[model samples]
Target: MYSSLLMILGALVVGYMIPVKHPSALLTIRRLSSWMLYLILFLMGYGLAFIDNLSQNIIQLFSQSAVLVSLLLTFNLSALYFVGRYLAMPAAEPIHKKAITSLRCLKNLRCLSRC
Candidate 1:
């Protein structure tokens, strides 16, 4: 696995160092690689379907995964809700909004992220 990964990274480094004069050929290769990836995934799925033990446990696996995912989403949303409520709660009235530097920093951060 390490050797394969090294080979792939080596290929990427070689490819990056080499400049292609005709971008059209590079575009074609990119499209071909995308299709090859889909084909590989399809074949992998098809192969896995033939495994007897996995077929038997598929339902249980799916159920466990679904429950885990739902719990994760629920907890995340609950935390988000609590955090939002805390943020929104009325605080001791400030003389002006200018008193909070954090709010202005967050606005600047938002602007930078968009850029």
Candidate 2:
């Protein structure tokens, strides 16, 4: 985790130093961001792969009560999503309206392309 933090910090520093007019700099940032996204996804997949073992551990800790386990898990996930939305710090309402409009345009273009 510390290594990942250091790597992110390094990337941010390098990204800040790169000249905006240089095409290669922007490309490098894009590639780095994509790789970082893939790495995170892989890590999440790895963790998810062990869910069965984790569930067993939870059962042991909770005395094999599935209902209690399900409720706890549901609440945890709900809390996470709510907190994430709260922390998203969305732009003002008008900007969001504009974004929605642009997204609708993009969807229309996609539909047209498909047709």
lDDT of 2 by residue, 1-115 (tens): 5997898889789978866877897788789889988998999779768777786676575675777889899999999999888877777666543333555767788655434
Q: In model 1, where do residues sit more than 4 Å from their true spots?
A: 1-18, 57-115
Clash count of each predicted structure = 0, 0
Scored against the true structure, residue 45 in model 1 reaches a CA lDDT of 86
lDDT of each: 0.82, 0.78
TM-score of each: 0.37, 0.33
Q: Which candidate ranks first by TM-score, i.e. highest?
A: 1
Worst 10 residues of 1 by lDDT: 96-105
Alpha-carbon error at 73 in model 2, in Å? 22
